[model samples]
Target: MSTGGKVQWINPHMMRAQNFTIRFVKPSRHMPGIVALREIRKYQKSTVTLIQKFPFQRLVKEIAQNLKEEFRFQSSAVDAL
Candidate 1:
């Protein structure tokens, strides 16, 4: 899926001007990390809009436990995200 716009540079050094797209790879049962990464990337893209309309603390409380158990994410890591 594409974000469908020019990349906004939060920091000049963080990204290039080249076009970017996210493509799905074939799923593998054994790679939970890859699955988590994909899900996080999807969330990262929408985070700005999501946070504006939703209560972030509520959302985090709802999903934090699941993220920790399913992906083996530490509390600090989930908080950082």
Candidate 2:
């Protein structure tokens, strides 16, 4: 043990100072359409319309609605795509 508690001791101040990690993960194949859906949600008539109009619209619509209502969002169907 070289002093810094453990292999994964997260110091909030240090982590903030270091800035967010720059992840290189590739966007899903439907990313562009997903973005488009975000721009269109304000005008969607129904969940069905959202699903029919965008790539992953069902998930995106649910997430957006949850975010609007709860101020937080997370995906449950992680393996669906």
Candidate 3:
């Protein structure tokens, strides 16, 4: 299953020049961490959006956890996404 995320421009001026969204095409069960991290790295260049679509629930949680752990997020900041 493909997870989905919105990649938004961190710079307001650059928003018009680039695509702001990306579909998570990597398989969740087999290599979720790798895919999530890779996507996060890609999005860090921009800004990663939260996944609210029903189909991506599991993948969202996995990615959220990875973000939380990796960034040492202590509150609902990351998970609240």
Task: Look at candidate 3 and tell me the lDDT of residue 38.
Answer: 85
> What TM-score would every model get versus the actual structure?
0.25, 0.18, 0.20
RMSD of each: 18.8, 20.0, 20.9
Task: Write one digit per residue (lDDT tens) for candidate 1, span 1-81.
Answer: 344443533443333444444433443244558878998999888846545323655566668666675435456664566
On a 0 to 1 TM-score scale, where does candidate 1 land against the true structure? 0.25
The per-prediction tally of clashing pairs is: 0, 0, 0
Compare the candidates by lDDT and give the number of the best one: 3
lDDT digits (tens) for residues 1-81 of candidate 2: 243433444556665678955333332344467868876875675444324434564656688787686544245443243
TM-score sort, best first: 1, 3, 2
- Compared with the true structure, the alpha-carbon lDDT of candidate 1 equals 0.55
Order of candidate numbers by lDDT, starting with the best: 3, 1, 2
Residues 1-81 of candidate 3: C-alpha lDDT, one tens digit per residue: 244543332554454467554333433354558878987788788745555545455566577787685534333554565
Candidate 1 least-lDDT 10 residues: 6-15
Query: What do the candidate models score in CA lDDT, each in turn?
Result: 0.55, 0.53, 0.55
